[model samples]
Target chain A: MKSTLLLGTRKGLVVYRHQNGQWAMQDVHFPGVPVSIAYADERNGVWWACLDHGHWGVKLHRSADRGANWEEVTAPAYPEGAEIKPGEPAHTRYLWAMQQGGRRHPDRLWVGTEPGGLFRSDDGGREFQLVESLWNHPSRENNWFGGGRDHAGIHSVVVDPRDENHVYVGVSCAGVFESVDAGKTWAVRNKGLRADFLPDPEAEVGHDPHLLVASPANPDVMWQQNHCGIFRSVDGGRLWTDISEKDGPASFGFAIAVADDDPDQAWVAPAVSDMHRLAIDRSLCVCRTDDGGKSWKTLRHGLPQGHSFDIVYRHALACSGDGLAFGTTTGNLFFSADRGERWQVINNYLPMVHSVLFVE
Target chain B: MPSVNFTYALKRFFPDLREIDLKAESLSDLLAQLEKKHPGLRAYVLDEQGRLRRHVNIFIDGELIADRDALTDPFRPDSEIYIMQALSGG
Candidate 1:
């Protein structure tokens, strides 16, 4: 299998292709100082990335030929009636998450953002239309500015593998939403979720599920890590159950990767504090759940003691057939061939890795 | 014509002048005046063809100029003009 791993780095997109059992980096610099996100379609050799252009604002670029040449394609074109306040960049649109539609809707695309909204692209990555239902939802007016990183921003969006119309999105401040009839509508599927960040912990929405991993094996079963804790939901998000216990680690982070073969096997790189997103105590780490959230084990076969390093950022860790791989803010890339049980530093003394993906 | 302070990065270009009070009515005039006073000043902020380099910015009393390529922004003598290098280091 000719698998290519597309990683969005501090500089730009770094492609790690397995060549002769070792990974080689292909540097692709997109405009803008730092490239926050990238979308690569390995099959068609096309890619797109978002760059931060400073006071001039954010921009998105498209690469049609294996990332050799690129062209600019910013969509919604500064929404009409959108206020362009002084000091604001002209094209102030920041593209957070970019997904090149799956098989069901090959021509479709989806994007999530910092202000917690969704934009869809039907013609690949050229033009976009905002998923206005979520942005104009009842809670969004208050939840959009859900206050901080732990509140209402959007980073993860999952379109149903089998049916592209069915979409589920996770908001930074809000809980999770489900739209079986595509993003045309949404229902806050946060029952059994305790939005402790709110004055009331039992609110239906606004619970802040930072990451939602819909099992590729069984879309019905999914896991999440949020401000409150770790949870698992079956019945297509109709209900959820807290899996975190006081005796164990309280799930707090922006990353969760489920094993491809087994829906029960999963991993979450938890941090010690909420403020320090990557801070870890080294007390216990690499939370691995094997019994479908019934039990979890703190895997630490090759991790360091208080000295090895305990912090892991939300975008740092990603998984594929290469077991599990993650990069640290300290500019170190780690790979664990046997799940999160052990780790080996592959690339050291590099820039802070914002994202890493393992392609077979 | 207004007094413009250069950002730290561009200060070395004008060794003797921390602030330059040039006589000009527009951004282009101020830039040309500075170029006349400090020979290589324009080259640092502007490219070979007089286009503003990506890293340079011109501000009028704190707000950045929207058009960096064609910066002919009007200015009054009393109004302060700020010229600086665009922030790059993260």
Candidate 2:
């Protein structure tokens, strides 16, 4: 079981450690700075902190021995001639996603950034180069737009555990893209996705996937909490199936987590529709699907029932073993021990949580 | 020689940051020299396109620079250059 929870909040990275059957606040890093992503690379025990500095721009930092020491690394940069459009020059506005390569490629790291650029670092994150193949895709110029931000961004990068060369990235307003040859070539995989905002609801591109996760036991089974609803892909990402609950609280949300051993089991934090963006009916609940979204069970025990305005971000919910944790926009953090059966408050006065990850 | 000073907020990242004097003719050239002295400082002041960051301000002798995109602003010898973060917050 992962015993440490890293909460990337607007103010800093708050860490909590579980010991003696109790979770306690362990340490805080980069206090007063907004940590967009707090990630721990389990392969090499290297921890990464992606900082969204208001005045200094985006920055990256890494720590080898946990949070005791950290070293700043060069953040990914768009090339000199790169442009978001004909006249708008492109720069890395935000670092949204970070993932390590397969075990075979130990030093390889992938970083997804705003302006829709995917960067790769071969030297363990000391330097990075833009993956131009995906950036120069034909659909990006006209089809890729922003969802919640001013420009398109890549927020999820899933590296195939079986083959390092195969990768998938989820882009806001651009849909899912698959690369079979180590990001040298790409193909659209939004066959069954629906974008209600577009003229064509089932367009090949322009789908908003809030978060994407693959089942550890069966990587072929992928799940995403999308703007439209919840979706599941049984055959990798070649095709998707809508799995959202019919006229239920699970219809809209941002975060999703799949069980490690069961592809049919997953969890999602439920909120109102996009317009409201609040807990359903002024009550907080987490919906669990044990049979691959065919049915859902609402878990609300130990949660606020009324007068709550908490909403979870895309990366704020995570699952490890039997442990489930999520942080809310209103600075409320909850943890569950028996899957989603019960929840306990971890913290209530932290800053707005951007991401939450369970690290070893 | 022109001496350049930085905002104290940057000291959080660059703890040893201090005033430095270098011989340069233009703001762009002076920034390149400053990058050599302190690595990664130029990125805080200028973006990937070499343009001054939107929220960063550079003043020559207490006057804000005129050119931000091309960085054609000039500075004289023995001039005092101040690089600061713009006032922005809720």
Q: Considering just chain B, what TM-score does every model have?
A: 0.85, 0.94
List where candidate 2 sits over 4 angstroms from the true fold.
none
Models 1 onward score TM values of 0.77, 0.98
lDDT of 1 by residue, B1-90 (tens): 478887775553356657867777778778888888776566556643345667678889878787776786666787788876666667
Given candidate 2, what's the lDDT at residue A12? 91
Give per-residue lDDT, candidate 2, residue A348.
90
> Could you tell me how far off, in angstroms, the CA of residue A193 lies in candidate 1 after the best superposition?
1.4
What is the per-residue lDDT of model 2 for residues B33-64, given as tens digits with 9 covering 90 to 100?
88887899999989899989989999999999
Across residues A1-360, which tens digit of lDDT does each residue of candidate 1 receive?
235666666666776666676666666565225666666653355677776444334557778776777776654333433222333222223556666567767778778765566778888777777677776787876554443442255667787778878888887777788888778789988888887667888877668776787888898888887677888887778899888745766477667888877788788877765666544664436788888878888776656557544455565677775368776666667667777777766676656666665543
- Pairs that collide, model 2: none
lDDT of 2 by residue, A138-257 (tens): 999999999878999999999989998889999987999999998999999998889998999999999999888889899899999999999999999999999999967887898999
TM-score of 2: 0.98
lDDT, model 1: 0.68
